[model samples]
Target chain A: MKLREQLTALLTSLAGVWIMSYAWIVLKLGSIHVPDAGFLPFLCGAALAVLGVAWLLALHWTKRKEAPAEKRLWHRPLSSLLLMIAYGWAMETLGYISSTLVFVIAWQQIVEKEKWAKTLSIAVLSTLAMYALFVHLLKVPIPSEFFLR
Target chain B: MDIFSGLLDGFAIALTATNLLFCLLGAIIGTAIGVLPGLGPAATIALLLPITYVIGTPVTAIIMMAGIFYGAMYGGSTTSILLNLPGEAASVVTCIDGYQMAKKGRAGAALGIAAIGSFVAGTLAVVGLTMFAPPLAEFALDFGPPEYFALTTLGLLLAVTLSGGSIIKGLIILLFGLILAMVGLDPISGKIRFTFGSIGLQGGFDFVTLAMGVFGLGEILYNLESTMKTEIVTTKLGKVFPTLGDWADSRWAICRGSVIGFFVGIIPGGGAVISSLASYAIEKKYSQHPEEFGQGAIQGVAGPESANNAASSSSFIPLLTLGIPGNAAIAMIFAALMIQGITPGPFLVAEHPDVFWGVIASMYVGNVMLLVLNLPLVGLWVQMLRVPYGILAPVIVLFTTIGVYSTQNQVFDIYAMLFFAAVGYLMRKLDFDPAPLPLAFVLGPLVERSLRQSLLLSGGDPAIFVSRPISGILMVIFVLLIVGQTIFFLRRKWKRRCCVPVPPETEKSL
Candidate 1:
C-alpha cells in the first residue's frame, strides 16, 4: 500500500511538472506585474508539484505499517466500468433504447448474476422507463436513430 | 423587509402549487436515497441537476434540491436503526446505538425519536438561518476582491485540513481542481489555455458533468466493489411514537445538538458528519449513564439525528448569503443556481427575494413532510432496502448518463462523465477524498477572478491580500494552518522513525 501511494504521489508530481511546462512555455506565463491567462494555472501547477513532492518525501521518511491483507473484490466494479464505457459508445451507434436495453441486460447478467427471466424483464422495463423519462417527459434529445422513436 | 415579512413572503412562494409539488418530490427522492446506502444526497442532486432545466424557475428548482438536502438527514437514521448500516455519512454514529436499540426491540421508538429530533433541530436551524443570513450577507456586501480571494483560499485550505486524509494529497487534488477550472477560454484575455483544440473542451468541463461523473457515477462504480448483506431488523414495530421518558432523556441533548450543529455548519468545512460525531461525543459525556450509550440508549439516536439535520439546514447559510458553497451538496445547489442565471451572493436576497426566502421557508415545510414520511411511513422506506442492487445500479447509470447528456445534448459530456467516474474510483481506492475537488472546482473561477482583480487594484504588489484587515487576518490564518500541519506531520514522522524496530543489518549500515 505504501509503495502504491508513493507511486501515486510521484505520478502526481510528474503531472504537475507537465502542467507547469505547458503553462510556462505554451500558454506563456507572463510577468506577475501584468498577469496573463496562464498565471493562475502556473501557480496551481507549482503548488501541485510542491505538494506532491512533499507528500512523497513525507511517505518516504515515515515507517511503513503492514496491514492484514484481505481478499478484495475488484471484478464487479471493473466489469461494471467497462460496461458503462461500452454503453456510452453503443448509445451513439445503437441509439438510446437499443443500446440501453443491451447494456442493462449485460450488466444484470455479468455483474449481478441474475436469472435470465428476471434480468430480461428488468432490462426491458428499465430501458423503457428511462426512455419515457428522458425522451418523453423531459424531451432530452438522446439519439433515437435505431429505434424507440 | 424584516425577517417576519421576509419569512411570510417566502411562505407565500413555497406554498404555491409548483413549488410545493417539487418540494414534495425532492423530499421523497431524498428519503429514498437516504434509505439506500451508496447514493448520497450530493450524488442524487447531481444526477437530477439536468431535470432542473425543465423546471425553468430557479426558485422552484432550488426548493427541490434544498428539500433533498435536509430530508436526507431525516431519513438517514432509519437504515442505521434497522440494519446497522448508515444511509449516509452523517448517520454513521446512529448505527452505534440505533441497531442495538433495534436488537432490544425498540426500533419503533428509535425511529420515532430520530424523526422528532430531526424535525426540532431542522426547524431551529432554519430559524437561525433566517436570523443570521441577512446580517451575514449585509456584512459581506462590504467585501472587495482581496477579501473574497482570501475567503475562498481559506475555504479551500479548511476543506483540505478537515477532509480526513494526508494534507499534501488533499492540497494536490485541490490544485488539480484549480487546474481543471483553467481549461477553457480566459475570462480576461479570451485566449484559450488548455482546450487542446477540442470544441467540447472549449467551454471547459460543465459543473454537472464533472459532478455527476465524480460523485454520481463514481459512487455507483465504487459501491459495486462489494455487495452488502443487509440483516434488517425484524422486530415488530410497536408504536411509532416515543414515550415521554424518551423525550426527557433527550431534550437537553437535542438542544445541545441543535446549537452545535448550527454553528458548525456555518463554518466552511463543517457539515453533518462532524456535527453528528460531535453531538454523539457530547451526549456520551453528559449522559447520566454513559454506559447506556452503544447499549440501546435513546439519547444516542436523538442527539446525532438532530445534529445532522440541523447541520444540513445551517450549511446553506454561506451558500445563500456569501455565494460560497460549504460542501459538495451545497456546491451542486450553487451550480443549479448558476445554471439558472442566478449568481448567488450578497445581492441574491435583494434581487431574488423569492428564491432566498422561498428556499428557506420550504425547508420548514420539507422538514414537516419528512417527519410525516419518516415516522408513519418508515416501513415503506425500510422496504426500499430490499430492492436488489442489480436493478438499482443499472438504473442509476442510465439516469446519470442521460442526465449528463441532456445538459448540453452532447455525447462528449457523457464521455467526460465516464472519465471522471474512473478518476473518482481510483481516488477513493487510493484513500484520497474527492469531496474537496468539486468544492475547489466550483470556487476556482471566483478565486482566480478575485485574485486577478485584487492584483490589478494593487498594481500587482501581491501585498493587497494581506493589506486589507479582513483579508490579512484570513491570510495569516491560512499561513498558520499550513505551518501547523507541516509541524504536525514532521513530528509524527520523527516519532515513527525512532519507534519502529530497525533490522540489525540496516541499523549497522545506518
Candidate 2:
C-alpha cells in the first residue's frame, strides 16, 4: 500500500514535469495580451506539480498506516483485463462475432469455471444479440475482419 | 416563451409514440441495472451510448437518457432495503434504516414510503427545474468569456470536494484530464499539438472512448477485484401501500428533503450521495423520535430516498443551463448531447428548446413511470439481482468493447479505452477519485477557449476576469473556497499531529 501511494505520487509529479516540458518546447507560449496554445497547459502543468508536491508532503507528515493488503485481489481484474485486450485484438483479426464468441466462452469456461453448455449458450446468444442490435438495428457498420463481411 | 406553453410543447414531443417507448425502455433498463449491484448510471449510459445513433432525433435520445438517470435513482433503494446492499452509492444511506425495517418485517412499508417520497420529490424537482432552468440560462447569456472561465474554474475546484479522499489526489487527476484534453488540434490555431504525427491523435481522443474506458470498463475491472458475496434476505411483503401513519411520519421529511436536495443538486459536484447524506442527518435532527433513526424509522427511509431522487433530477440544471455537468452521470449526458451535434450551454434553452424542454417533460413522465415500475414490478428488478456477476461482468465487457468500437469504427479507440480502464483501476486502488477526471476532460476545451478568449477580449490583461462583475464575484468565491480549504486542512493536520506521537529524530527531520 505504501509503495503504491509513493509510486502514484512520483508518477503524477513526473507527468506534471512532462506536461511542462511539452508546453515549453512544443507549443507556443504567447505574451499575456495574446495567450497562445501552450498557456492553459503550462498553467495546468505548474498547478499539477504544486499539488503533487503537496500530496507527497502531506503523506510524509501524516505517516498514515498502510491499509491491510488483500490476498490475490488483483488476480481476477488482471485476468479480465488481459482477456479484454485479447478480445480487442481478436476483433480486428477475427471479426466481432467470432472474437466475442471466443472471448465470452473462454471467460465463462476458464476464468469463471462455468459449465460448458452454459458457457457456449451464453457466448453464442450474447454475440448474436449484439450483432443484431449493433449491425442490423443500429446500422453501426462495425468492421468485419473475417467471417461476416 | 412562458413556462406553461413551453412545457406543453415539450410534452407534445415527449409523448410521441417513439419517444414514449424509448423512455419506457430506458426506465426499465435503468431500474434493472440500479437494482443490480456493480453497475452505475454513468457506466450504463457510456455502454449504451451507441443506441442513441439509432434513435434518430436528439430529443428522443435525451429523453431516454434522462429517464435512465432518474429511474436509476428510484430503483437504487430496492436492494438497500431488502438485502442491506446499496445498489448504488446514493442508496448507501438507505440501508441503515431500510434493512432494519426489513428485519422487523416492515419492508413493504419502508419500500412503499420510499416510492411515495421519491415520486413527490422527483415531481417537485422537475417543477423546480422547469421554473429555474430557463431563467438561469437567460442570465447565463449575459456571461462573457471571463465569466465562463471563472465558472469552469469554480466547477473544477468544487469537484475536489466530491472526493472522499485527499483533495490533492482529485486535483492531480483533474489536471491529468486537462492535459489529456490537449491531445489533438489547438482550437485557436489549426496547428496540431500532441498528436506525435499519429492520425488517430489528430482527431483527439473520442469522448465516447474516454467515457466508456474510464467509467464503463474501468468500473467493471475495479469491481472484479472484490469477491462480493451478498446474502439475500427474503422478507414477506404483504402490502405495497404505505399506512397512513407512515405517511404522517414522513410527509414533512419528504418536503424538507426535496428542498435540501434541489439546492445541493444545483451546485457543481453536489449529487445524490451528498444530498441524501445531508437529508438523513437533517431529518434525524428534526425528528421528534430521533432515537428511532437507524432502527427502521419511516422518516429515515423517506427523507434520503426523496433527497437522492430529487438531487438526481435537479443535477440536470447545471448541465442543461450552463453546459457544466455536476457529476460523472451528467458528464456522460453532456457527452451525449455533443455527439448529437448539440453543444449544451446558455443558449440550449433558446436554441434547442425541443431537446431541452422535451427532456424536462420526459422526466415528469419518467418519474410517473418509475413510480409505476417500482411499486408492483419491483419483484422484476429483484429478479435481475439474481444474475451472478460472473455472467454479468463478461457481458459488460463485451458491450463496452462493442460500444467503443461502434462509435467510430476505429480500433485505436479500443486501445484508448483499455488504457484509461487501466488508469482508472489504478486510481481506484490508490484512493484517487476518477469522477473529477471525466468532468475535467469534458470541460477542458471549454475552459481553454474561455480563458484564451477572455484574455483576447481584455487585450491580455489578466485583471479582466476581476473587472467583470459576474466573473469577479465568481473569482472571489473561488479564492475563498481555496483559502477555506487550506485552513481546514491545516487544522486537521494540527489535530492529527497533537494526537499521534512522533519520535524526536523524526520530528526534527520533519
Regions more than 4 Å wrong, model 1: A64-66, A147-149, B491-510
Calculate DockQ per candidate and list them.
0.53, 0.57
lDDT tens digits by residue: candidate 2, A67-100: 4566546788888889888988898999877888
Q: Estimate, for each residue in B132-196, the C-alpha lDDT of model 2 and write its tens digit.
A: 99999999999888999999999988977654557888788888888888899999977688888
RMSD of each: 3.2, 2.8
Listed per model, the TM-scores of chain A against the true chain A are 0.91, 0.88
Clashes of 1: 0
Task: Give the alpha carbon lDDT tens digit for every residue of A5-118 in model 1.
Answer: 889888888888888888888888767667888788888887778877877877766555565544567898899899998988898888888898999899989998999999
Judge the docking of candidate 1 as incorrect, acceptable, medium or high.
Answer: medium
Task: Report iRMS (Å) of candidate 1.
Answer: 5.1
Best by lDDT: 1
